[model samples]
Target: MATAWFPLWLTLKVALLATLGSGVVGILLALLIARSRLWLRDGLDGVIMLPMVLPPTVLGYYLIVVVGRNGMLGRWLYERFGVSLIFTWQGAVLAASIVSLPLIYKAARAAFEEVDPSLENAARLLGSGEAAVFLRVTLPLALRGIGAGLMLSFARAMGEFGATLMIAGNLPGRTQTLSIAIYDAVQAGDDHRAGLLSLLMSAVCITLLFLSGRLLRARHRA
Candidate 1:
């Protein structure tokens, strides 16, 4: 019990950070995709969402090749910065971010797309630049959608397992996050602990979904 607290808290912190980072990137990318006029928008949109549809193991394998110590970018990082992502907490965050990115992107894109283009145009006519209009007129009105996206992304990150396991491995007090911990408990025949962890994970995910739905519904009414 005592040994579990810090690791669980650290896992939550990693998930929170990954969710925020991915939410920001996802929202920005979604906005750009929604505003694009070229046919390339469709292509880019598909590519951005590809991770959501792909197998987690496959994604982890590729990430390993790109960021693992023996991989290209990984080798460079180790040589220069003495940094390595493989089997590290940061690598777990990276895996979570990639896996949860689509949730935020889809929500934010829908929100952005629902906004009237004329509103942006009107803001432009009033001397507001594109960035200003997005920050003020667009994002403010879409807060609820963005909130839903963030919540969902955070939930996804919290539950992420396969990819995180593949890339970060199961190193307790280091890289073993909640999901991995649960797996370890179950596999080691510690059914009692596994049951507790499962209950906790389920409660968290359900709460996030419930709250997100409420926010989305409120936004719809507004």
Candidate 2:
């Protein structure tokens, strides 16, 4: 039924956008962290990695505190721009991005760290600017690990439920993503729908993870 299939499509859309948002942010953060020599680098890395260990509900609570209508950032946005994230698809993307960030962050950081510093130095010696060196030398070398991380992050985003539920209420045809849809189906005693949705999501996530593993193994081989 079209009604039953909405969640799967919505989830794929959200997960793809979330992966893009998180991938760019994660790579930027990883570059910053990997290149920094400050003593606070490790502490910053720990902070970025927090979502990996924190409960999804806890992450949802933090997001609400920061993005709720009355919260500082949320209030400012509402007042200045009339923007609101709560109970919207964009909110779901934000939740997924936060929940999935750690996967890409860890992978990107490790990739950046593993890149040869001497290669970057040589680029600099050849009159390449910092940005040029990153694009021409650092990024190419780190692409494999970053790619693996991005695929993993995509899978994680596709499965994000708790945080997304809290921020973006399950509105059929609006924000009821695949994971939330499964929960809704189970709660409504629709075992058939629930099972079908579960299988679909599982298949998609498994494909993503398989590709990620292959990328990682290829990286190791290379």
> Which 10 consecutive residues of model 2 have the lowest summed lDDT?
1-10
lDDT, candidate 1, 60-135, per-residue tens: 9999999898999999999999999998999999999999999999999998888888998999999998789989
Reference-based lDDT, each prediction = 0.88, 0.91
- Over the stretch 47-140, how does candidate 2's per-residue lDDT look in tens digits? 9999999999999998999999998998998899999999999999999999899999999999999998999999999999999999999999
- Please give the TM-score that candidate 1 achieves against the real structure: 0.91
lDDT of 2: 0.91
Off by over 4 Å in 1: 207-222
Q: For each predicted model, how many residue pairs clash, with residues at least 3 apart or on different chains?
A: 0, 0
